[model samples]
Target: MDLNWYWYIGLGVLGGGVVGWVINAAVQKARKSSAEVLINKMREEASKEAEHIQREAKVTAKSEILKLREECEHELKERRREQQNVEKRLSQREEALERKNDSLDGKLKNLERQEKEIELLRERLNNRENELQQSISKQIDELERVAQLDRETARQMLLEKLKNEVKNESGLLVRDLLEEAKQKAEKESRRILTYAIQRYASDCTYERTTATIPLPNDEMKGRIIGREGRNIRALEAATGVNILIDDTPEAVVISCFDPVRKEVARQLMERLIGDGRIHPTRIEELAKKIAKEVEDDVYSAGESAVLETGIQGVSPQVIKLLGRLKFRYSFSQNVLQHSLETAYFMGIIAAELGLDEQKAKRIGLFHDIGKAVDHEVEGSHAQIGADILRKHNEAKDVIQAVAAHHGEVEPVSLYDVLINACDTLSASRPGARSETTELYLKRLEQLESIAHDFAGVESCFALQAGREVRVVVTPEKISEGEAQMLAKDICQRIEKEMNYPGQIKVTIIRETRSVEYAK
Candidate 1:
């Protein structure tokens, strides 16, 4: 039992020793681990601080670099500005120097030219003085020898001679100029008139105020005369025409001073005869229908003329008036035909004169349009036509041409002059106008009597169908100047006393016959 107790005690002691050693070692290990943890923590803190310091240094250095760069840029910019200012000043100074140099050069050139001019003047003055002295001495000697007169007398004689010569020469020059101008004017007038006449081929026809309507049978005349002349009276009243149902076989005669009325009457008679109607009502109805038809025909005629002449923008009223000319007659010449001839003449002349040909044709067409209503209107045809054109908003030039075509107003354009000439030409052509034998003979006799009435007129002959009168004057009675005056006087007298279609030319001939026997 004792051995077992001792063994138990030893085991206990040994166990206690082991436990203490383990507890010590465990404590040592814990201490070592905590120490290592502290050192590692300190190392991590040092690394964080070093990194933060490095970042601050970098920020500070970057700020310093940015500030230095800005300063350097500022200095560089200032230096560049200074350099630019230096360059600008230098350029300005250079330009100023150039301007001063140019001014000096100009002044020097002026001085040089002035000096040269003064030198030349001095030399020329000296030469001229010597020449004047020589010339004066020579002129005195020569004048005394040649003229045998004093200086004053020679001067007066020379002045008188020059004055006489100038006077004679100037008179001759004036006379020659006047003659040339007169000849040129005459030639141009003749050329323009002749050229217009030559270019246009006018188909002239005699227009009659009376129209004869053919009847289908003798019964038609009675129908036209109608029940106690009621039909004839109705037509005459409705159309303002005189319907004469004479004993003529199968025909009716319609007469009126107004051609439009006559035309309407003629058409009415034809329709009534064709329809075999003999009542006044039918006569009136047909008259109205024919009148409207005549109006349409008139418009058609006017339009045809406008188109043929290539004229545009004519008012409807003016065109209607132009159409009335279709049936009108002027001294046996168809007025429309006369107008066409005048228009063509105007176009030809206007083209030659480099004017607007279409405008000229328009003026010609409207020139005689007033004649259509002249019998009804109070004013002259030219003035009335001008008023019509003005009302229609025609151009100023066209209106003036219309007003001045007949010399009622002063011509304002070449077109107006051409229209007047064309009008005269159309009226004056051969076979253009017809006059009775009695009237024609009377006109010729009147022309001759007027020429004979003038003093110094020995014999007068009418030529060119009374267009010209040649008066032979005695040379002893009338001088050349008197002959011209006598011609003008006769022309004026004829114009005032006579009513003629065309101008009459008065020519006075004076002959001084020097008859000597040839040995």
Candidate 2:
């Protein structure tokens, strides 16, 4: 039993020991596992702290690098600005130097020109000095050789000698030249005038003042007188002509101051007498019809005149105006006939003189065209005719010729002078125009009055039927030259103022004879 108890206790104690050991081992293992877990957690915390520090350092480095790059860029910009400023300063210095160089070049050019001028002035001064020295030397030599004459005496002697020589030679030369010129002029003038006159032998017809009209019967006059002379009165009033219906068998006398009006009245009376309707109303109507017919006749006559003259391209209006010259008269000469004759003569002379025959014929034909309407128009017929020709677009030379035919305008062409010469020859031909008794006496009075107007004339006489005018001049008051001039002046004045058919030969009789006979 005892052995069993001991054994049981030993067994129990050993079991207890084993249990304590197992319990101790389990507690120790648990402590070790908890310690290991704490260590691993601390290691992980340390590694995390190191990683965070590394990240902070890397960020700081990147920040520092960026700051350094920025600072470098700022430095580079500053360096570039300094380089630009240096370049600008250098450019300014270069410009200043260039300006200085240009100024120096201008100054050098001026200096060079001044030097050349100084050299030229020096040369000129030297030349002038040499000329003055030579002149002075010559003057000294002259003074030493001869004595000076008085200025007035020397000049007077020279003048007297020159004057004597000039007077002798010049007087003879002038006299010879004057005599030769006079002879030549006389010969040439005679030739020209003779040729002009010989070439143009125009027919001159005397203008008759009386117009004749044949009546139908003697009883027609009683009808013309009408019941109370109303027909005659109407005829006179319409035509400005007096009806002379007495002592005539088969004719009626028409008298008027105007020849045109007289012819119109004469024609009107004839028409009324032939119609046998001699009343005041019929007279007025016939008068108007006859007036128109006469006007038409005048136009036709003018056209015929122009056609006869071989002048074409004349306007109808100009022809009508020219026809009016048929009834017009100048110095007892029919103006239209005279113009035609003058045109014929002018054409002949123009052919002889180697001129334009058509132009000459036209100018001569229209020369007196204005005379037809001169009473109604102003100015001379030549000037008026020129206006008409110009309006018709005539040649410039023709217009000039027409205007200068009467010497009223300055002759611009040779044709103008030729026209005047031809006109003069046609009018001044012998027996061309007749002078009336009243006109003859008036011309004689005019001659006497013109002669009296002269300074040396004592008396004047118009002889040869006013063809010659003799002026008796006082010998004591007039010299030969003065007498010649007086005669020319009288002739010119008579030509200008008087309407004569032929030229008047002016004779100045200056008598200086003394009647002292020794027996």
Candidate 3:
């Protein structure tokens, strides 16, 4: 019974084992099928997604193509438009060229015709000269036979007698006419000049361009110099002037090319020295205040000048510019005072000449107005003055006179000439101007030397205080055109070789004299 029980147990165990293996295999198979189905379903989904992706890509590519096509089409259109424009311009240029060619041809034809006409006229003149020569020869032969002398002797005797008589009469006539006219002109000019000078005698005032500030002590210079020179630098930066604090004991020197800056710095220095508190901020503040004060004083000065001159209806801008001349100097002579003197002289001379006195005075007052802004403006004072006058709506005559005062423009009226004379008179007066004699003589010599460099120049004079240079040229050597060219060359040389203050007038005088003595 134990054996049979063992056998059955063994078989049961084996059967159970087989059954478990089969179950496990079936489970594995079932799982594998489910996994395959899942994988297939995933593949289908993936395929669908890929198709969707492909569709999106195609759509994107098509849109991109459309954009690119539009862009290309726009670019092509632009190119076509540009080509059309270029062609149009080229055609227009061609037409213009054709028109120019036609005009040139017409001009050429006209010139040819004129040349032919000139040739014909020349031929006719030659023929007429031949006929006249024949007639003269026949008359001469007849005269010789009648006089019973050779042609040479008879002609010489007659010519000598006629020359003697004509020479004496012509010389006397020319001498008398020239002497009378010269005397009258001299007398009138002297009278006018004397009357004008007598009527308007002005006080001579000269200005020195020195800006030396006297400090109380040398210790004060250290304060002005500040820590590491910030004080001096601030003063320089504020006033646009150099504050030179060298070994100058108890004195500070200010240097600048601009007079306005020098004056401003001078006032600032005085105030700072009085205040005894020197700092950068204080410097800037004081500089501004002093600048404003100076400006006001300048304007007042201009107003005072205008009132003194009795000028009416003056433009505020012009008056302001005129006031700036208070600090300006020409050859150490105060420009403002010089202008006042010039105005007075102009008025007096105008009265004597029976001219408009107010107008004359107006021109004189504004003649040097350009000097006020010349530092800030380009061009000569005369041209700048004219432009300023034009901007101010000044009278055309007055503007012309101001421009011509320095011969920058041709004189259009008597005022222009009068301004020159009065300007010279004012400047040339004794003690009116103080120039370095050595430097003045050197400049004049240099100017003359510059003119002498040009060929055909007989002599050159620096007149009008070196404002004008008169060059006398040999008429035989320099023609009229060459004289003008020589003047220009000399002027160019002067401009290149030397530094001058004002515009120099180069007058080229070319004259010939035919002189004879009657015996």
Candidate 4:
């Protein structure tokens, strides 16, 4: 049963195989169609994509072309603008160069014109010089022919006439100049003198020879006289003055011709009397103490004088010497005070005249420095002061001023003249100096005797306290020129004989007046 069934199954299997083959072929065919359809759709899609890609590439190419075109246009526009700026700058340079060229041409033309003008003027001057030379030659020839003398002689005569005329003119001119100079000098002298006197009015105090020291009683004199006049002798020796012990009851007299010594003695005596110890040792001690006090006072006085004069940087030694002058009396006036007053006057006048006030004050203040040491040192105060100033390395102008103040040397600077002016003002002021009756009479007699010895007989009178001497000369005996000559001779005699502080104005008054009186 299984075999027959196998055969039937095999037959069915063969049929089924045939059917299955057909169906399989159909399915395969269907699968092949479906693949072909898919391939076709993919091809169609690819063609569309390729076309879109090509359009997009065309659009990109167009955009690139537009961008390149815009860049090219921008570059062209910038290049055009740069070219315009360059052209405008070149035009400006060209205009500047043209103006410079025009200026140079104008300058050259002006220079040429100036040169031509200078040449024409030179030509004219040369022609004039030639004409002048010709005229001078002709005139010389004519003068030589007219005069019998040679050319040189005629020229000399003509020169003589011209010289004479010129001399007369010059003489007149000189006379006018002399008159003007005299007037100016007089005006200036009066102004300077007036200013100097008015500015310095320092009071004068005379140091008397007899110094008074009031004692408590007469018993103090015995104590002052010490054990055997030993105290008085020691005091006199120490002070360089005379100590007069007398019966004048309550006062002791210190006497000396030298005012400084007298002052020192008086001060020492007063100190000793006040101390009430009158032994020789005590007298010596008091003398030294008083001397030191006097020295300190002198130094203070000197420093005060310098400060009052407004001078600075003076040497201490000079200051000390200046202080010593406070005790010195010259012609009854305090010498140091007088010097300070003179310095003030000089400084004021110097400031007014626009001169060096420091230099003028320095000279005036130091002018009397010699007076401090004059008692110890021998020489003219002016010369001594000059030497001291030189020792201190003073400026030459200052030294010259010191030396020339008293006419010891020729005054070289305005400061020298100013010092002399100050000195004169100080000495010549009223009540500044005094003379004894004997000395005044002697000076007057001497002056009159000297004037009487002159060639022109004249009566002389000492006027203004011997400051001036007026001589009345006989006009009949002395000619006008002789009167001037006689006055000069008398002045010379006075200068040679007398020792005076200032200049004496010499006035020779010669009047020729004819008088007819009807009665």
> Which prediction has the highest lDDT against the true structure?
3
User: Model 2 TM-score?
Assistant: 0.56
Candidate 4 deviant stretches above 4 angstroms? 1-180, 204-219, 237-240, 246-262, 501-519
Selected candidate, larger TM-score, 3 vs 4: 4
The lDDT values for all models are 0.85, 0.81, 0.88, 0.81
The candidate with the higher TM-score, 1 or 3, is: 1
Clashing residue pairs found in predicted model 4: none
Q: Write down the TM-score of every candidate.
A: 0.61, 0.56, 0.56, 0.60
Q: Scored by Cα lDDT, where does model 1 land?
A: 0.85
C-alpha lDDT of candidate 3 relative to the true structure: 0.88
| Residue 298 displacement (Å), model 3 | 0.6
Model 4 lDDT per residue over 93-151, tens place: 99999999999999999999999999999999999999999999998788778865687
Q: Using TM-score as the measure, what is the rank order of every candidate, best first?
A: 1, 4, 2, 3
Question: Candidate 2 on 452-493: residue-level lDDT in tens?
Answer: 887868888889877798999998877555666677688789
Stretches of model 3 off by over 4 angstroms after superposition: 1-180, 443-519
Q: What's the residue-level lDDT of 137 in candidate 1?
A: 90
As for lDDT, the candidate ahead, 1 or 4, is: 1
After aligning candidate 2 to the native by TM-score, how far in Å is the CA of 450 from where it should be? Answer: 2.4
> What stretches of model 1 exceed 4 Å from their correct place?
1-179, 189-191, 212-223, 245-253, 274-276, 512-519
